[model samples]
Target: MSFLDATIVNVALRTLAADLRTSLDAIQWVVTAYLLAVAAVIPISGWAARRFGARRTFVAAVVLFTVASALCALAQSSGQLIAFRALQGIGGGLIMPVGQIILARAAGPARLPRVMAVVGVPVVLAPVFGPFAGGVLLDWAQWQWIFLINLPVGAAAALASLRLLSRDEPQASAPLDLPGLVSVCVSMVALTYGLGEMGRDPSATAVLALVAGVSLLGVFVAHSLRAAHPLFDIRLYRDQVFRAASLSSFLLSMGMYAGMVLMPLFFQSVHDTDDLTTAALLVPSSAGAAIATQLSGRATERFGGGRTVFYGALLGVAGGVPFVLIGANTPYPVIATAMLISGAGAGLSVMPAMTTAFRALSPDQIGHAAPQLNMVQRLGGSIATAVLVAVLQNGMDSHEPTQAGTMSAFTVTFGWVLGAAVLAAWTALVLARAQRREPPRVDAPAPAPQSRA
Candidate 1:
């Protein structure tokens, strides 16, 4: 439901702007606010679970998310809606990570891949369905219905959580890293706000926000080094697999999102397709991705993360070629095939990378791992969008205002995406090498030696 909500409003952007009497730039905050809040709160999920118990926290988050949805539906102004969405984000951000933690804990290392495969179904489907559902709803109903739909689902999930969730006994609590938290929050907010404002005005406050965000992040790194128990233990980087996995995940998102942002434009501008047709054309990719996610998880378990990621990256690179070569006269079948392959590649890589990274950590380390991973992925997408947008705009400028020029721009931007895919593939290779070299640590004590003669 949360993931659905993330994209649901996208289709309703025009309606929202008209209703709120806001410009496109101002209205974008509706999405930006949610993303920023999600990024900010994810880092605290483990702490919240420890402080309030996972069951309690999970239920509370669901309820909060549901109520915030109601508030969003009722919002009369852009500001109110944005604020409500931010609240929704706070709850939504915690849901998946915490659920993954619980599942990981329950399934243990041996069963984790299976559990991840099961859990990944909705993660892939939600985004695919979100915009389509939102468009349908907007055409027939009001934008408020977009949020209202979550009520029943949230209620059911909350009830199920109460019954299904196992309580973790309270362990010794670490003091909250208040300074680190504040610094990181400032950094993320500034960075997101800045990037979101790109292509608008070079002299705008958004650029200043970006600068401030980077400065705050610098402060955060410095603070983390000194803190007794930082919000995120920087030491996790020392684990080569974890480092590689994290970097690969980020790069994967960058490439995936870059391609995603360009695809619709490719269809609309190059193929001269209408909105509905473009949407219809795009559906297969997401559907393929959702289906592949489960399969990929199983493959990861059987074949190992390295091989799964390597194959996925290879497919991703292969998929990019079609898009780069696609033209104004390209056939639907060709576009569909490209999208399906790319989506499947993303499915193959994402879950395995996430599961493998988390698997590297001890049970206790998950609190930190979940949020940090989420943060990296979000940041990667943000950066990718910024860079891709610039690339597209630059390409657009270099040609005449025609279908061919638009196609040219898209092709150029996709080239960058292909580069990112190659980088992701290389990162997977690095992980494979590192995994082969590192011996697994045995946490339990070795059996006591028999009494020696």
Candidate 2:
């Protein structure tokens, strides 16, 4: 529900602008505010869980998210909606990471592969399905239904969580790091919103925001080193396995998520299909992801994470090759095949990489690590979007809308996606080597010889 809400409202942007009697720029805040709020709140998830038990925190988050969703549905103006969306984001941001913490601690490192596969189903499927579902809803229902749909799902999740989740003891707490929280929140919100703006309109305000965000990020890092109980422990990166997993995630996410933007444009510009038709054409990719998720965990357990990721990245490259050389006249079947292969590769790689990260951390560290991974993945997607948008815009410098020109623009960006996949493969190999170096040797007993000595 949280993941779906993040992307679903995008398809409704135009409709929102029309119905609310506002410009696209104004209605965009409805989405932007939610993302910024999520970014701001992510660093606090660990603290929240440690302060309150996981079960209580999870229930509260769901209740807050569900209540905000209901409020969003009832919003009378753009301002009201954006405000409520920010409220919703505060709740939405913690749900996934907190849930990961609970499951990771319960499942233990041995079962992390299976756990991640289960956790991954909705995470992988939601973004792929969000826009399509939204398009369908808009075709047949009112705009409010998009937000309203979350109410039942969130409520059910909350109730089940209350009954089913174990009441684990909360960790010993220190005073919240107010300065660290402020610095991190500011940096995240500014950077995320600025990059998002850069994708749409590169303005002075966006540049300033980026600069401020980077500067504050430096401050936060410095402060974290000195603080006893910082929002997150930066030293986690000292673990080679965690570092490698994070790098792989960042690169693969850039490659995979670009498709969310690129494929839709490909269908609209080159094939001249309607929204519904384009969405239908993309179903194979989502299906491939679903299939891969079911099989990837066992593959990771058998072959190890490095080999699994390496193979997945190879599949990604093969899938992306078609896009690099694509022409305006390319058949839909061919494009569909490329998307399917790409999505399958993504689904296969993501779970193993995440599980690998968790395996590198202690149970106590899982809460912090989960949010950090999520934040990095979100940042990766934002960076990929900005980069691709710039690439596409540069390729279309002549302002031509011809199919050939559009195809050229997409080709350039898709080439980068291919390059990112190759890098992911290399990183996976590195991660494998690091994992090998990490295990300590178990010595055999010296038998009766020691007694004689």
Indicate the residue-level lDDT of 354 in model 2.
73
Q: How many clashes show up per model?
A: 0, 0
In order, the Cα lDDT scores of the candidates are: 0.73, 0.75
For candidate 2, write residues 161-192 as lDDT tens digits. 98898887777667777898798778877876
Relative to the true structure, candidate 2 reaches a TM of: 0.85
> Candidate 1: deviation at residue 157, Å?
2.2
TM-scores for candidates 1 onward, in order: 0.85, 0.85
Give one digit per residue, the lDDT tens place, for model 1 in 1-453.
776786667556656878999754566567667766777777777777777777787788899999999999999999999999999999987786667556655454566666767776665555456666765676567889989988999999999998988877644568778888899888877776676556544556977988899899889888888877888877778898789889988898777656554565566557765445555667977866876786886797677776787788877888878877877788889878888888888888876777777767665555566678787776676566555665566677778979888788788878888888889999988876776676333231111101000
Residue 446 lDDT, candidate 2, scale 0-100: 9
How much lDDT does candidate 2 score? Answer: 0.75
